[model samples]
Target: MASSIHDLARHLNISIGTVSRALNGRADVNADTRQRVLE
Candidate 1:
C-alpha cells in the first residue's frame, strides 16, 4: 500500500500536485485521472 502522496504519485507516474488535486477533487484534474487516483 502507498504510505504517502509521494509514493502514490510515483506509483501512478504522475506529479504530486496531480495526486493532491485528484484527492481534493479539484476541477483541473481530468475525470479519468481522478478515478485512477481514487482507485
Candidate 2:
C-alpha cells in the first residue's frame, strides 16, 4: 500500500498536490480523478 501522498501520487502518475486536493475533496479536482485517487 502507498505509505504517503507522494507514493500515491507517483503510483497514480499525478502530482502530489493533485492527490492531496482529491483526498481533501477540493472542487478543483475532477470527479473522475478524485474517484481514481479514492480507489
Best model per TM-score: 1
Off-target runs (Cα >4 Å) in candidate 2 are none
- For model 2, how does the per-residue alpha-carbon lDDT over 1-39 read when each residue is reduced to its tens digit? 636999889999999999999999899999999999999
Candidate 1: list runs displaced more than 4 Å: none
RMSD of each: 1.3, 1.3
Which prediction has the highest lDDT against the true structure?
Answer: 1
User: Local distance difference test, per candidate?
Assistant: 0.94, 0.93
lDDT of 1 at 7: 91
Candidate 1 backbone collisions, by pair? none
- lDDT (tens digit, per residue) of candidate 1 on 1-39: 636999989999999999999999899999999999999
Candidate 1 similarity to native, TM-score: 0.90
In Å, residue 31's CA in model 1 sits off its true spot by 0.5
